[model samples]
Target chain A: MTETNKTWVLRSRPVGDIKDGDLELVESPLAPLADGEVRARTIYLSLDPTNRIWMSDVDAYLPPVGLGDTMRGGGIGVITESRFDGLQPGDVVNTGLAHWALYNTLPGASLAKLPTLPGVPLTAFTGPLGATGMTAYFGLMDIAKPKAGETVVVSAAAGAVGSMVGQIAKIQGCRVVGIAGSDAKCKWLVETAGLDAAINYKTEDVGAALDKHCPDGIDINFENVGGEIMDAVIARLNDFSRMPLCGLISTYNATDPVPGPYNFANLLMRRTLVKGFIVIDYFPRFPEGIQQMAMWLMEGKLKFETDIVQGFENAPASLSRLFEGKNLGKLVVQVSDEPK
Target chain B: MTETNKTWVLRSRPVGDIKDGDLELVESPLAPLADGEVRARTIYLSLDPTNRIWMSDVDAYLPPVGLGDTMRGGGIGVITESRFDGLQPGDVVNTGLAHWALYNTLPGASLAKLPTLPGVPLTAFTGPLGATGMTAYFGLMDIAKPKAGETVVVSAAAGAVGSMVGQIAKIQGCRVVGIAGSDAKCKWLVETAGLDAAINYKTEDVGAALDKHCPDGIDINFENVGGEIMDAVIARLNDFSRMPLCGLISTYNATDPVPGPYNFANLLMRRTLVKGFIVIDYFPRFPEGIQQMAMWLMEGKLKFETDIVQGFENAPASLSRLFEGKNLGKLVVQVSDEPK
Candidate 1:
């Protein structure tokens, strides 16, 4: 283990898009774990659009990550030291709001012991079978519950959570169409994720493309990108449809208030449901969700891709890939090697 | 029987406010009833905010009303002539989409025989126990499902659907607060409808009043007025809050597109639900809904007020009451006298 930890400190609140100097990487001496505490060495630090929210002073589900504090994030790590009976060295744990660093130490109660499955890589725990996977699972199954023969539209179809949501809807016997930025991502959604159709939103007219693909009308909308794409999908919603709002990456760094869907009146006109959710709200049911997700993974019914950036030094730049649509599947930084 | 039937025809789509010239009252020769059809004499024409939507070319759940067609509406009246086995003269039936007329003839399949309740006035069917009431019934009980001890906030609180929503939420043991446009409406919401608190939006600071009344956070929001009032309630929503979007009367006459709640992102953050519906969707369960509404009315557990505008000539002006926040309860236009 290194004598010092590399931690990203919030130097300033982002004005628009997160820039290089918004968060500064600072080296600090590693602190010894106290009683009732455990130390986690980050193996895979997950990067998400929500990272931008915690950095802002905006009102949100959670309190803003204090200025000069280590940037709030989630990761899968192995415990290197434990003073609590529930944790031991080499135990892999999943964290909700850990610091963006190589080493994070807190009371043992703050960590969750993730159940493992055979042949499933630890990185999978950070991507598909961990919080990201659980978010897709609960948001789709519990909230949207798209039935067989229904048409489902998912934006950000190439990302970690959106990819899982598309596969799960397909398993439920739905005709799925995904909206992604690039033609390559659209191709992966149709060919790899087994979606019925994929619309390259950047090139194709989303509303017309949606009309062509979704003749039966949209029964469910798993929205990640939230501006015009959201409005177009909302306009095509069937009566009594459901929209599981997982994220709004489109406006994450806007300096001013982003105007909402002008056609939100459709929610009233069509009797459609639009619900926003965070996975931590389902923490008590995480085990049940993980079990279902693992079964799907083991059965080869669910497929995934990850953009794993190497080295701790590249973590900051890797996060920008999410906003730029530069990364595919799960975005993560591999800070260090897992324990032998 | 009268030789001529007075009916309003949509002459042209209104640019902003619905004008007298928009709907021309036309006199048509009373046609004989055809096979499997019945003729109904309009007693009470139920005026609603959706009347404006059907008039516009905007994409909606139902198709736009064609120009020169009888203006679409709902009404309660006695069957004057019947060619169907299920209906007879003097039998009162409810029609979902009758025109603003003195007499209407439609296939019996289009009419629903509303159950008779002792001590219940026919106007109650147009007000609290009819389409407007059913909208409040299903929207609150089935969609929002505000639990006992939760706080419910309603916009347009003194209007037809909003009035019923407040009472129903109260019956479910929820603490209710209402936002209305006038001090008189606010008084009626508190003194008559039994709301815990009422905010006069025109005079009171709604956001501050809501904070003071709903210190525990709002759990369910029955939004009838959209735009700013909708945005204010959204900011104060509790985690897992539900919003039954019954209408957006505030923007019904806007010539340009109305912007939605800026804090709509709260739907994602708090996992809140926003759903819109029309009463006809619950037709299969109308008997069940009417039965409950009747029982509540008879027991005096539910109270209602109808802003009844007499004379067919006053029908067009009555609708404008909704946008102007002039009606106290259900806004109804009585075309003819009710049977003794």
Candidate 2:
């Protein structure tokens, strides 16, 4: 039997913003499964800011996606044929760099069997039940470690990982404040995500707002957007404040190098801990994270929003959604149908 | 009995470099020791880069030294007269804010009695065995936590704190690389302090030098001089790198606000940690740190150089020695004579 596969292939590295023709969806024949390998049908493609980083030829967490190669992505896929003993044809797998494709053929050991999380859709496996959720979990609990009554501030608080960060910080008894671009996003953070305060970074003077909101100064900063917003939050950092340096989305598209925060000396004066972490570091405990996040989701204490664009052809353009502040929560693409 | 006290008073805030009269050596009549007070004669007055920070009306580890107030310092002093039960005549006391003065009247409880070492000089109390030593100990050991075979880079490696940071990192079994302004300081770091490598930041391209010295990337960065030096070291950081931000002497005398390191994003890219710390935070453990450092010193494994600028009259002018790279190691002003 033969099948036609549709995949988004990198045409060229992006200069600033990813444009059309940068990633071209090409048609190809699916390869027959070999020993220790499996053929999988892609279900969901995770569009993230890191996707842009991978699209560029700059130094990043992973090597830049090679020209003419499939666009790197995180996604959920269902195996159709397997020769490896570790995976069966009926298995649904969650994996990294699964590519923006309708089907894939790879070693079976590379993919993890998707955890059974009831009430959580397959879309969540690309988001809250995947690396996105785990990023929020460890970046908050492990790095920031917010305590009760402490003022916890999260930037990009309306984004997928950030929204979870605010909710989880609230669960930890922290006075959560979020920094987002839109007034509507601010409203959702306060009303829906349980954040005590939301600073619309676009309209509000963040420094003054932080002073009024975090009167005791910020004990923890969950940074996603790095720019003046980070500088404003850092200026109000209390002694021994923790900043889990995750993403600097503001600079991902910049043509030149991004300058360090002007008030960076606060890192010393306040004795702050600024640590960068990647979700991949917590892969060993992904099962534990997924389980905890599942319970929170089932309990209604944790809420996530998935802003998904259908069709693999739209995958490349959708990644710009994160940098543009266009996506409401988790930004992803659904490429193919999954079995019920 | 009555005595005349001489003090360096803050005449004006410095702009770029401190001038001759930025601090006025004013003579004041010493007040008689009241109940619970002592008349202490200053011995060795520490002239440090922080003096410039304190001189300016900017935010620092301590409040800015106000105009007309006696200049704040750290020093070793001897009690000439006492009315308090806690102190008596001829008792040597070490304290912070020792003031660039010949005499001071205060409650004796604020001062710590200097610990005696058979070979250690009175200058060691204000230098190696004091706050400067403690800064190096905690910033390197507690913040960086360098392991065996790790590459440790220390900027301002010839200064009081930076010198010790490199030496202690050596004791911790790490490859020590020193960054200093002059060839002499570089030579001393390698020849006297037993550093693995030395980079004369003035003569060599720091980034290239770092590449050659730390071939495997830097594990711990004991940062003292900020700006280009910091940016250079940060670019060479390994994954999970730790930087103990101690001081930013290069920016101390700047007329304008100092810019942040241009490559600060390495904190995220390399998953590095940049933690700012002050030694006072570890005051409860000072005795423990001093004990360990003292043992290291006694073993001949640790060596210290004292830059003593004699005469209390030159104390204010001598402070610029730190910023000018005139001092070899621990810079201090000998205010009064020690008993024979």
Q: Candidate 2 regions off by >4 Å?
A: none
Candidate 2 local Cα displacement, residue B157, angstroms: 0.8
Q: How would you class the docking of model 2?
A: medium
Residue A18, model 2, lDDT: 90
Residue range B1-340, candidate 2, lDDT tens digits: 5478898899899888999888898888887777888888888888878788888887666789899998888688888899889887888888566677888777777766676787777777665678899999988888899899999999999889988999999988999999999999999999999999999988999999999999998999998988989999998898889999998888878887666887877788889888998888888888898899888877877789999888999887788788889898888888778855
Q: What is the lDDT of residue B251 in candidate 2?
A: 81
Model 2 residue B264 lDDT score: 77
Alpha-carbon deviation at B250 in model 1, angstroms: 1.5
Compared with the true structure, all predictions reach lDDT values of 0.88, 0.86
TM-score of chain A of 1: 0.97
